[model samples]
Target: MTNDDLQFTDDRPITTQAQDLLDRAGFAQRLALAVSSWKNQESLVISLTGGWGSGKTSIKNMTLDHLAAVQGCQVIEFNPWQWAGQDSLSSAFFAEISRVIQREDPSDDDRKLAKLLRSYSRRLNTGASLADGTAKLLPILLASTLATSLLGTLAQGAVAQITWLGVAGASALGSLSLILQRSGAWLGRWAGNLDEDAKDSALTLSQLREKLQKLLSTRDKPLLVVLDDLDRLSAEQMKGIFQLVKAHMDFANVVFLLLFQRETVEQGLWKAGFDGADYLEKIIQVPFSVPAIASSQLENLLFKRLDEILAQEPQLQQRFEQDYWSRVFQRGMRPFFSNLRHVYRYSSTLAFHCRLLRGTEVAEVNAVDLFALECLRIFAPETYTELSKHKALLTGSDPYSRQDEPQRVRTTQLMDQLVSLAPVPHQAATRQLLQEMFPTLDWVFNNTNYDQGIQLRWLVNSRVCCDEVFDRYFEMSIPEQDVPNSLLHELGRRITEPEPFTILLTSQAEDRQAEILQRLIGLVEEFPLDQSVEVVRTLLHAGERVGRKISFTNWSPRQQVTRLLRIYLQRFEQEADRSQSVINAFALTPGLVVVEQLLGADHALRRKGDVGYFDDSGLEQLKSVYMRKLREKADSDPDAFLADGDQASYLYDLNSYSEGGDEGRRWVEANVTSPDRFLQFAQGQVSVRTTHCGGTTTRTSYIPVSSLESFLGLERWTQWAARLDSLELAEDQCRTLALVKEALAQSEQSVTAEESNR
Candidate 1:
């Protein structure tokens, strides 16, 4: 997919006329009917409640849209939160209502009604708005009058912020009586303007109600003023809005719709010293809460856009199975995101990172890995961090790696806890998917009783699951140089054409060549048996072209070919023909190195004890074939037989010789000439001396010097002691050498005494 497809977009509210998604729940129709039924009500308030992201705003928009289309219906949308921070909720609500009324109902009489509404708001500000600056000025005009009036009660209880710097609060209060005298006649004039009867009056709650009725006389059919986002206001603002609405309603032909989240509104009511239920029931004629989004609807919405992104990846469709789609990817990816915005977050990230990977990185990665990892990265950043930091442990790269004891029992416990960051039902499924994408530290699956094919498929299309790839996916720098698609595809084409494949890789150094081969071998494992064998043949061919500068050092050329075969053999062990073919592949080599390498395959090195991977009979057959090859080489060239018979003969019960009597004598004489070489073989460590000898060089096990002494007879033992004495040795080495030295001296002395007696 292109980068533009992956860019995250702004989450604009779905327009009310944009095909009414709320119709899925039939909320649109139900809410429309409820609003239509309230046509003749004198005054009423309705509340719509739901949690954040539960589509409260959407529902309000839908209701407004429905009402706006009806005959002679005027819908006025008032957002209190837009003005909540700018001034008092009482003044803000009245001002917004004045604006909407003036805009929607602008006839000559409606204009007069708008002017009267503005004047009524000023009266409310004078008596009730504890925070308005206009209210602050009223105390000067009505100080003594307010002492016994409702405005006086509010003035005593409310403390307006009047700084003493300029308008000193004390000085203002001190001249209150004089100011009242001057403003009395002026207040008298303003009172005449406010009252239709032209009587001087104190603006009380009863007076405010009378003023609202005068404003509503010009009201059109069922004026619905929607007050939404009330929950977005502060506690004080919320209280002020509710109080203002309660006082102003009761005028005919006016209806108020108040929208809020239940808990937030309840908390505001409780803080205001009113029982939430009691207070709500008193004002609201009808209360409606939206039902939750259904699982089917949520899934449809979530994956709708994602299907387009996946359409770009046609190869992924063929590589993954139905189980991976339904059982792993779908099951694991769906639970973490339930909302539209969350779905966008996960899908966008997955697309961007997948777009970044190219060449072998893409070819080696699994689709599910990218999908699930991006999901974790968005919804669970901490868990994603764990995956990046502990890739080897999570992916089974280091099989023996684990925390000690109690921790070992729950191998993925930390991951499990991290996995718990997702919902509970998802934990097991997510764990299974991660294990599939990344190899587990322990080959054991986190969840059993589930179908798991080879994990190789998980790495087939991408290495996004690899730690290095995971890190680079987030880097802001330019992409690093990596093996290109041209090279990887060329190598793939020569799967069985070893000559050109080997020639193609000849430029790489031995160590680098082996490393690349290991990667290729792993990548090949993801394919079917025939495809895997084809890739294996090409990888084996690469050994012939590798530089011998460090050839056969760690992964010897012969071992490189055979190591992959051993992996293949274990996987297809039931297919006996494939097993024989692997044996035949080992047999095709022209040199004796293959024999030595194959013979030591079953032995335990420095790592663990012998693992029962290959069949015992198979290993024996491999060993017998290798031994016969060695005998044939010895028969061709006597000096070519450097293998000592004692080590094998101890177990094999054979002599210290090759197959032919002449070669066996020569093999004995060769060891006899340099007994230290024989001594070195017995130690099972690296031999210090350099010589042209073909043998198994990797010593993963160490044997004792005493075992060597017991295994060797008089001629070999005498030669061994002479060399140990002549050679320079460390204190520890001298101690072991001295043991043999003492035995040789005692044998010589006994022989001398026998000669003297004769």
Candidate 2:
């Protein structure tokens, strides 16, 4: 989808039935009816239990929405998470109920109820604790109504940041000490009148409870207090909340609604040295598990989102294969999603990646395969991360030669680990999906093998099974050094049109020219035989213009183009057809070096008596066509021919193709008239060799006397040496000329020795 049409789905709980993707409205409506129909005088506590992200909050909100029309029902939502890591959870609970009661225009009864709540809280805060026969001070800073007010002011002002930690750090040491001293004085006074204070406090609290019960009993509407996300609170906070509910459970015409993930709440309570499940059973009068969303419903919602996104790109929709998607979705994706939250998460992540990759050449990736891979990215992130680093292991073919059993064993172990990252129940499905996407792993899992012939089809179709385009799928864009397949296709289509084709080929940067040529070598393998004649001719023309700039490595632009031509020519099975394609290419374009290199491969194969593309006669005819062109170029502009970028290889080919090196030596002798020209000629005569030393290989270039003698006769070489020696040269020039003369003397010694032996 385009950026304008795309949006990430949020994780908010749905408030109305219309917003519900799963069919939970019926259950929510039934719950609302049950709560509204309650006529008992005793307080009711209902617990909505489910796993996290299982739509408990959504169901709760929808139930509240259904109850909004029922008269005389009030909701007080107290999110315990807001007061997390604080000592004010109990104070905050009563304050919320009092605030909601006071929110209505405060009648005398409402004000009286608020006053009774304050008095009861004060008694509880001032009461002495004797748990385990030890006098332990409670967190009294926020227990009373006056103290809660002070806590609110401090939280909104200077100590706001520290309040979240609930007076539990070195930063609050002084403040906590001052608070303890203030409460300690009150405790001391109470201790002085211990018997009297205890008796009076007990009577006063009993009187307050009776008054509060009578006040709540007269109310026409029942009060519903909702406490959600209870499990998100700390362990102490969860215990405090449950303790608060238990202490206040005797009130009349009041209902408490608590929603949480059961396991999280149980774990939190258990950490605080309480039997969590037993603690919950004591507080919660009635419990209802949030209904599980069906697998089909989740898939429907996911597919609906996917269709909306995929509809924006018509080409991707056309490329989507329904059969493969079904296999992957049923076997691989169905296990991970158990709720609407997962569907939204997967859709949002998929939409973001699709937006980045759309309307670009990288969008040519197979849509079904990308969908499955994106699924893995979300559900099995570790596997996705390692998959990027191990492309060769995933996409590489089984070896044709001897097998390395140890390497295969290692690969099998790694593949098992990757599949094991998924949920245990889905591991088999994950393995099946991986094998379907990457057939190379078939050998590891099922002992199935794939040959190298199918690789071209995979590459041409832009499947992830090919290494060339694998990075684009993960990076969401083409890598800088890699050529885009769109550009490759465009070049192939325009190969017959020489001017535009040459411009396109030469327009790439010097650093990327070698890679671009390498990709084209694969692109040419897919070309049809009918177009080979014109395509080869245009490629030769382009290769002449794109001659060897910063591409001096083994796979230079020239070498790549030569390889491309060989693959393109093999499209024609008959030797005559291949020879004619090469002849026609040379007849239209005058590139001598590239044609010579192309035929050289066949010459080696033919000499070894292997099955080659061309016979001796066909090779000679094609050579004669380029040979005539080379002679004309030498005659017309000899300086330009000698100044070619690959002049060394050209001169070598020239001597080897002509009779006894007469024609090539004449051209060289005429060109080597000056000291600089002779130096250039000598420099071009150097032989390159790679030698291994101390576990590393080094390339050394030196002019060999025998090669120079083979190119130019000894008499001519001596004439040039004497001419250079007679001149008064610079220091560097004399050094260079001396090296040449030293090698020439060695050549003379070898000639003398050979003559004496004869």
The top-ranked prediction according to TM-score is 2
lDDT of 2 by residue, 453-501 (tens): 4565566556787777788788898777667766776787787877798
Model 2 ranges with Cα > 4 A deviation: 1-8, 69-72, 83-95, 101-181, 184-221, 243-253, 269-285, 303-334, 346-403, 409-511, 525-534, 547-554, 571-585, 610-621, 645-686, 695-758
Tell me each candidate's TM-score: 0.63, 0.73
Candidate 1's error at 245, in angstroms?
1.6
- Superposition TM-score, candidate 2 onto the true structure: 0.73
| Candidate 2: residue 543 Cα off by (Å) | 1.6
After superposition of all CA atoms, the RMSD between model 1 and the true structure is 10.6
The numbered model that scores best in lDDT is 2
Candidate 2 achieves a global lDDT of 0.74
Model 2 superposed RMSD (Cα): 10.1
Q: Report lDDT per candidate.
A: 0.56, 0.74
